[model samples]
Target: MNERRKLLLHEKVEVRQLEEGLGGSWHPGIVIGVSESCRKVRYDELLCDTGKSKLIESIPVTGAIEGLYQRPFVKSNYRGRIRPRPPSPEHFDVKTSLSFGVCVDVLFKEAWWEGVIFDYNEGGDERCVFFPDEGDERKFKLTDIRATLEWDEFSGHWRERGVWTLVSLAKEHKKEGHIFQLVKRIWSRLKVHYGFMKMISEWTCGAYCLW
Candidate 1:
């Protein structure tokens, strides 16, 4: 099996004004790595995460080298305390869920293993020949991917919502078994359902709805 080599490049990031009351001022830092799915950019020169940090800051990625290995996708972590409910207590309180969305442009390369082609002989003896899998050869093109983040204060949790888009040349040519559009639709439904459930549970205090 042949392994593909990943490329790396060094880059710098500068943060301007982020938002009011969000904490922290504009700062500069370094971007160490880029993966097929995520970008790892860190900054400590300005101590933005410090308790005293306030105000919003935007980090600009420019003049960055091309073909850097991106970071892997990881689930966002949420930590909060949930208020306990008293059994046989007073009236219930209505809760509302908070959510935000952001759009991003990502470029990554992914490879899949396709099946091999076999050749057989007409005689009693069978000969098998394997051809390089064409299904695995592809460059996924994604644009204007929208990602959302939702926080359930009542449940003390946060979740992500969105269906990422990917364009596959092999799928367009009908050489691959799966269609990119179909896959994206299915994924979208799943994300939407999960997000809705999270909101409903928080609002109704774990009430189940039919339909």
Candidate 2:
């Protein structure tokens, strides 16, 4: 048997975004993956709200590299005004909206345990117990999470450019309900994009690299 190879901290992280969505409809925004060492990457989906309608906006994935070993997380704030629709004499229903945002320090960690052993007794025999060590485990943590909205523009697609600053972990709180809601919405969108069967096929073989 070959010994398991340990991966470098940075080598264990991955980030990717959903390829579909009209900027604001909750597409895959950011995905971060980590390995046992704590190396991580964040992939964010950026949306620009052009003056045009929300349906015609383009959202793109932006890449950011973060290393916790370098420094502590910082906080950032962003503000902007957006016209949900193009200005027109007939478009009296259009409204101007102001967006305020903040981004704070986010942290991630991962760990794994391999080849753990267990012991057991057979036939009521006190000495008949043995265990083998074999398995792997992983974990991830995000802290000081925040984001700020800067300026929003609408051309053919929606675009929002902003400055992201890390914040203090003291202000962070876990919102499992909100997280679950967002995840549910994203999964709904994914199901619509790819039907049940196709989604299963792609998830098992294509997107997740299960095959």
Candidate 3:
């Protein structure tokens, strides 16, 4: 993989959007043009709120690059289609038994991130959760934490802490399917613009090489 591969015009890439406490999220865009002797790129990013494309120009080349996957950073809404159903309150109560060192998934940037509870004040509503992968810790409400779960494809249910929860895994699977379909549509458009072989090469190499 080469980090020095020159970014060309009309390429699909993602721009990094940094957050205050949370590390960051990548938003997808298409290279529309280049400037400053090709040190910067002009691109169009989809507006999650308006359902329209917005043109952003002169983004540094280092800021915009290919992503691990060709999908938008959807917030709240799933592919701008529907909001994912939160874990049913009737099924499990996270707050009553919340404690330190308990494994849970916290909803952040519209996705479930695995983290372990590090501290919690009894009778308080928030708990400190540590995300080891990011080497970061943050506070979250009980409503945002769900029991750490693994999908059991064979039995078609979610396993909480290695035990069966009996909740259908269909919604999670459906969300994943929606993302795959959206990526396929974007890939088709890129192929038409860049041709199959070139698109494959650029995509496989990826913008992550720069970092």
Candidate 4:
């Protein structure tokens, strides 16, 4: 919170901005300048600014020192709203250890690439042991490793038009005695009668099964 008051020009920070006639959310931007007259700040976008320096505190993080907030409190008992917690490196680290071999997207030189975490480096910095699709094996810092939802999974889960079922769908997918049953029944008998099957194939264009 005190560091928020001491925000310097050109300092990069993730800030919350509420816009007029629009929604509010957190965004990453550089602090272009600070208002000398007031506690406002000038950052990206026309109207986004920092709030009261003293009040712009993060939710208390365990082991975090007082007077500064890097992340917001995830739960608010008084407001009765569960605030989303910012992504933590510790969570990712634990996930890497628990869920090894899971596909992950790693950021390298500003570009995201598909990879898997096989191991971790035994160093002061938490570097990931990554195997990329390009056949390059290397260790990366946590800041450079990010996990994004798989595109196919995201589409299937969100659009509901894909092959995978993402949610608890109550509606049954199969119905008894559907129209195609008649076609299947006929085709089964026809194939058994070789002469009839030959004649039918010659008579009709072709047999096609509907999904």
Candidate 5:
């Protein structure tokens, strides 16, 4: 039997982004794994708008702005503060006495919003169903709900809060202009270019090491 190697795992941390010796941004991240050398750490990277978790490594722990996982806000230029995606099943508690067709308040940015149970699954918790929209009532995992909202009739927002406004959305569909199409082309090219660079980086490192 072999003894396990020691690893430094950070529960909550902020990763600072530095580019071109100019701009800097902080991103929420958690150290999930450590490299065999103990020189690098693999972490759950949280992105703005959509809470996308991506693994980033081969960097020193000093690169991260140490902090708590409680920081859920990601600064954005277009939408200001975009809430990151909810934590995985590990971090959420999904027990509820509320039943199907019951009105509930969904959690968003520390506030409760309207949400309705679409369908109750046989398996409770982590599999609770919520249908906030009518025509597009989609069944979601129990972990998706923020919390159950209590009925308040006296509030002025009874009608508005009774149902989620974001679900029943109204928007105009305008044809994409030439600028939009051009932006898409540039974006695709940038992706290919960055991907090529990443491939080269991995290949260069792999060539120098035998392990």
Candidate 6:
């Protein structure tokens, strides 16, 4: 059954935060009470602050249907953790056949990361695709792949998220210098090795000439 139908009372959940300063964050919560129709629920919003979590009883407000309620989507993996949930896979329709070298966003470590499909197996009910990112190869179900797109800030509209294939994740990783650092380290090691070998060869030639 789907997540909505399977959600029951007392089950832990991660509620999406829509409020200011906490927008886009997924906060830990639990189903404390359920209405007769099951359309409405009273859940406790576990306030997460500085690695501490405290529960606050959900109270229904007048004329507000979304009061202290959420769609109980993914199960809560929170142990005093608060971070934005990855973009919903439902946003993109994967109708086309995924082939090798196709750039796609992968749900890795609870975040949508840029990845390229290297290998694929379509025999099973859920197609398994391999992505080798940062020298680590891992298999992911087809459902976990989303079309790579970037939000166009210049447009100033939510619907303007565009697919600029040439610079898919370039701007996003500018602040993260680890990739540049890794490349620099590899280059430094190669330079050191080359210098050492050149010095040894010169010394050997000089010794032979003197003999």
Per-residue lDDT tens digits for candidate 4, residues 40-121, read 2333333323543322322221211122345435221111101122245544332323133334445543234444444424
**What does the lDDT read for residue 47 in candidate 1?**
44
What's the lDDT for candidate 5? Answer: 0.34
Give lDDT per model, in order: 0.27, 0.22, 0.44, 0.33, 0.34, 0.37
Residue-level lDDT of model 6, residues 152-201, one tens digit each, is 11221122123222122332544444533343343345335665345321
Q: 1 or 5, which is superior by lDDT? A: 5
Which pairs, if any, clash in model 3?
A: none
lDDT of 1 by residue, 20-101 (tens): 4221122434446555433354454444455564323332222112222443232233211111111111232223111111
- Worst lDDT run of 10 residues, candidate 6, spans 75-84
Report per-prediction Cα RMSD to one decimal. 22.2, 24.4, 18.5, 21.0, 18.6, 19.1
Model 5 bad stretches (over 4 Å): 1-96, 106-113, 125-134, 150-211
- Residue 39's lDDT in candidate 5: 31
The candidate that wins on lDDT is 3
- The candidates, ranked best first by TM-score, are 3, 6, 4, 5, 1, 2
Candidate 3, residues 1-211, lDDT tens digits: the string is 4343334566655444434443322344556675533323333443444566564645543212222223334222111111112346587554435555455667666556556566636467888776533546788887887666433212224444421111112223444335323433544454355443443322212122221
Arranged by lDDT with the best first, the candidates are 3, 6, 5, 4, 1, 2
Residue-level lDDT tens digits of model 2 in 73-105: 321211111112222224333222211112111
Output the worst ten-in-a-row residue range by lDDT, candidate 1: 80-89
63-95: candidate 5 lDDT, tens digit per residue: 112222233343121111111233443554445
Higher-ranked by TM-score: 5 or 6: 6
Q: Please report, as a residue range, the 10-residue window in candidate 5 with the lowest summed lDDT.
A: 75-84
Give the higher-TM-score candidate: 1 or 3. Answer: 3
- Candidate 4, residue 2: the lDDT equals 43
